[model samples]
Target: MARPSTAHLGVDLDKAGKQVGFISIPHSPHEDAWGAVRIPICVIRNGSGPTVILQGGNHGDEYEGPIVLGELIRDLDPATISGRLVILPAINLPAVLAGRRTSPVDGLNLNRTFPGDPAGTITQQISAFVSDVIFPIGDMFVDLHSGGSSLNILPSAIIEPAPDPAHRRRNVEAVLAFGAPLTVVIDNLGEPRTSTACAVRAGLTTVGTEMAGAGTVSLDALKICRQGVRNVLAHAGVLLPAAAAPAAREPEAILKIPGQAGFVFATADGVFEPCHPLGTMVRSGQEAGRIHHLADPSRPPETLRYGADGMVYGHRQPGRVVLGNCCAVVASPYEGSLD
Candidate 1:
């Protein structure tokens, strides 16, 4: 069994009104012996209903989520919603402050530190609190994410296909209701330590996003996230349904990433030259991009190819890349429904 978490909430989670406070995690670093890292948290409860946990800043560089969630926290009236909305706009405060993917304090990626250890590092402790405490109160989990500083991704709702048919259907419904430009069904992306994985293990209806990313927030992506979150909340019965917009439409496409094969990695360190933009369809073994050996003008550029036939879902944002870095990811059209 895991150790009990040392984290504590500053506000009452069970209260009947809007409460905003911090999740104070005890951190005794070199500078301070009794210091605590206070993560921003807000709980909005009307009457008794299901609880939805909304998280952002899982990866610090992703700004779209934090921006949208923050807006929701400030603008959303507690009276308009039932149940609760537990908001964590900047979950990884250290990373968000540094504007990096991983925590500056522990150098660990918060996303991969799920089901965390209470007796471990700061990042692990935060994860442990979420897994052991917060998840138990949540009927659904919505983790908002973008490509962060690494890649540019098409705006899409992402989910891992659950083993149980009924559970899988609910997830599908939530994703479709989110109504992003695309719906991506990826089986944990070959890493099961993510927030989505932890929430799934805890039996919460989990949904994530891969909105526009390239180290900067996009206005279009923000618009998509804002509306998508509201739609999901309404679908979960936490909030009353909003008036349908005149431009409302179903998701533009549904795609699936075939395990690890869907991702194309850099084989050597060099400047990447992408051959196609996001959403371009290509066949297996097609040239996805090349790594130019800028240092050695005489050396031939290392050509990279797609591992499968699919649309380009994402690619590295930075011009330079190292071996094993994900250069591109492809997702095939999902013909069958998760249901």
Candidate 2:
């Protein structure tokens, strides 16, 4: 069968039975300091069926997603599958190679620049590529992400509002298949800047999976993601394997906290001694943690307290705690939800 052509954005689909490759969606040249960066994509199709795009490395520091996508490409046997699979392991090449959160030149987040501008900044150019070249070709989508530098997030999936019940159910079910202990279903709270949300708005069943952390790879997390991808394929009938036994369902809940309620740090520079562990539940007035004068143990420790009751979702890693830096994140139930 002949592949479809997209002339508007210089995209062409090259297919071999169930395997298809998208070639040469041009990106704006990187700044002089960063050298040139090109965006490349490949699509694999298995006979005739639904199309799915699996993307990773939206944030340059998230390693697990890109690694897992690499493994998927290597292990995938197109002749054995039923539909098409588009794999983009490095969506933000410059950011990925630079090991930074955003493009070094633009200093803008690629993830937040989705549905991009054709005549905008470098980040906007990449966003336009995804919006024009990628989103239109898929029936379902999975975007992979992780904690950027200096943060460790428990593996979870983010499911935004679905346009319909069927898509919503599939979104949740697909997330659960990833076997992450936590699954956060967010309304996105008007953050339309996200790729997944953009895809969802475009009427695609999209979900974002969060694995490992900051520029580091965890083999265990990779395994979980790998299995999760396969499970999603099986669920979608792209792969003919039986679904794996389900993992224990973690207590599912939404977190609510004031928009202003995040990690509160001390004004003076000092050594931080956290009084709480990750996932600790705290009340509004409870001391979440503290900072102390490194040289004077006698001096009073600066107390950090929450403005609301909730569980800690994340905390500052061992390092200098700067003023205005978030030291902890408290997750409460859905009444005052950000989602």
How well does each candidate superpose onto the true structure, as a TM-score?
0.95, 0.82
Q: Where is model 1 poorest over a 10-residue stretch in terms of lDDT?
A: 243-252
Which candidate number would show the highest TM-score if scored against the true structure? 1
Task: Give the 10-residue window scoring lowest on summed lDDT in candidate 2.
Answer: 1-10
Q: In candidate 1, residue 171 scores what lDDT? A: 84
lDDT per residue, candidate 1, 1-339, as tens digits? 336778888989899888889999998899999999999999999987899999999999999999988988888889998899999999999999999999999999998999888988999988988888889889999999999999999998987678788888878878888878888987765687998888988899989998888999899999989889988998888888863222243433668987677889999999999999998999899999999999999999999999889999999999999999999999987766666
Model 1 score (lDDT): 0.88
**Model 2 residue 179 lDDT?**
62
Error of 2 at 210 (Å): 2.1
Residues 1-339, candidate 2: write the lDDT tens digits.
112322133234446543333334334453344333555466677677888888987888888888888877777778877888888888887789888889875898998898887666767777776777678878889898877776666666666667677777667666666566566655545588889888987778777776757457877678778777777777667877664445455335534344455445555667666677767778887887777787887889788787777777666664567776667666666553222
Predicted model with the maximum lDDT? 1
